[model samples]
Target: MFLNTILNSIIQIIFFAALPFIWWLLSARKRIPFTQWIGLKPWKDRSTHLGVWIAGISAAFTAVGLALLFAFQGTETAVSVFSGRGIQAVPAVAVYAVLNTSFPEELLFRGFLLKRLQAQFGFVAANITQSLLFGLLHGALFLGTAGVGKTVLLVLFTAAIAWFMGYINEQKADGSILPSWIIHAVSNLVSGLCAAYGVL
Candidate 1:
């Protein structure tokens, strides 16, 4: 099982890594520099992006805080990492979750999709649309394991948080996905560790 999981995660990581370039080639037509278009450039403005310091740091903490709250009192949900798979899986899970799931998700959602949507429409509609898509993806991933009620709550909660993340990427991060990516990467790390330790 562990081997299978690792191989599968590796495959996912590769695909996720390719997705941005794929988008650049197919949809974006590669007009803008791929890195800049994906908002992978250096911190544009500290006063805006992470200049406040609190913006980036707090996002990570908030994700951890929310996860803890969910584990302790809110609707319980089972993620793939929540298996009783022993400590041996912790490192692999953390690395894969952060690289495959967290990184790609922010790139695709906030960097690519949200930016494109915002260009066509406005921030509100774009944010909501991307947030819903983000939430729905999580709901689908968890539905089989987490059941309907928990999935519903999870979707709503995920979408709400995602909207805030979108806001941060645009308003606070100066169109860079760095802030939300840090937030998500930290969240995934903590969650993966907790689940491996059977805390979640």
Candidate 2:
């Protein structure tokens, strides 16, 4: 099971990282930077984008705090960690989670998927659709380990967070995904630390 999981993750990472380039090549589109196409463009309105980024960070934390308060009665959700494994694995996992998991997920869901969906459907539909997919993907991954109820809650929480990211990403005129990526990477890093310390 562990090997299968690892292999699956590796496959997903490779697939996501390569998908945009593959599409570009096959479509024979005009020369455009991949980052822009993937919604990683430079910020146009610096102050406005920064303001929205700050507001997004605040809102995300507030929502998470409130959800935890109400759902768990102000208690920390118990987190499972590597039991017999040494602390050596913590840093490695933390780096991989932030770099591989967080970045790629943002690129795929918030960047590629969200933009494509927006072009097809409106912004709101795209945001919601991507968020739902993000949530279900995560929830399904941990279903066996976290069980039904916790996984359901996790799915809801992740979906909410994904929506926040999508909203922030679209707030920019160029649809920059940098702010959302920053937030996600930091969040994943912190979560990884908490898990390492068994404080999640």
For residues 1-200, could you state the per-residue lDDT of candidate 1 as single tens digits?
45655676677756765867787888666477887888886666745436555355556555744564464343453244444676788767766656656777887889888998999999999999999999999788767766788778778877887887898788766788887777776666666666666665
lDDT per residue for candidate 2 within 102-185, as digits (tens), equals: 677888998888988998999999999999999999778767766688778978988988888888778654688877877776
The runs of at least 3 residues in candidate 1 whose Cα sits more than 4 Å from the true structure, single-residue gaps closed, are 1-10, 17-19, 26-30, 47-87
lDDT of 1: 0.72
lDDT of 2 at 13: 67
**Residue 70, candidate 2: C-alpha displacement in angstroms:** 14
Index of the highest-lDDT prediction: 1
